[model samples]
Target: MRVTLSLFLAAGLAAIAQPTLAETLSFTLDNQTPNMIVQFHATPADGGTRTELLKKKGLYGGQSRKLTIADGSDACVYKIRAVFEDDSFYDVRDEIDFCENDTYTLAD
Candidate 1:
């Protein structure tokens, strides 16, 4: 009986130790000229590697955008860039933190 009680308490304590996560994080970019192209990439802060999210063409002073990445326990950094066919590019980046573990419920 004592061993079971101790195990139950330990599990409850462990559950309380987890952290919560934010709902969303997003960004937009401004392309320099008409019909300019851009690429969106994310680089995890853990020094893993950079992943390409998107590429598109834009109008003058046009916009490039991206949405949610995935439901994962790891925090990551993201970067966006405008790349031209001529090889000229401009980049913007930011980092977002995520919960490694958390108890959550869906919002209706």
Candidate 2:
């Protein structure tokens, strides 16, 4: 009985040590001109292979939308950018660190 109890406690501790899955990264852009297009990217080290995960037009005036970042990708910094229909652009290209179970949340 003692041996079985020890094994059960060890299994429980191992499960608790595991990290929880992180939430997806998100951002919002508001007041965009109608009919304009937006773009976002997840930048990483080695200066190679940037992913474009979202592309959509302005849905409403003074609105906010959340950006999505995929799970289980290469580890490195991340950033996002936007491009309007009229060739105008806005970029948020900051080297933000990301952990396997870390998440970022933006407001307004």
Show where candidate 2 strays beyond 4 Å.
Answer: 1-24, 27-37, 57-61, 71-76, 97-108
Model 2 accuracy (lDDT, Cα): 0.54
Query: Distance from true position, residue 37, model 1, in Å?
Result: 2.6
Q: Compute the lDDT of residue 106 as modeled in candidate 2.
A: 27
Report RMSD (Å) for each prediction in the order shown.
10.0, 7.6
List, residue by residue over 1-108, the lDDT tens digit for candidate 1.
999999999999998987766334344433435544544445556664565545353323444333344434255444334455556665544443422312111111
- Clashes within 3 Å, all models in order: 0, 0
lDDT of 2 by residue, 1-108 (tens): 999999999999999998876445544434444544455456654464566645554434345565556544545466645555566665654566654324433222
Candidate 2 residue-pair clash tally: 0
TM-score of each: 0.43, 0.44
What is the alpha-carbon lDDT for the whole of candidate 1? 0.46
- Using TM-score as the measure, the top candidate is 2
- lDDT values for all models: 0.46, 0.54
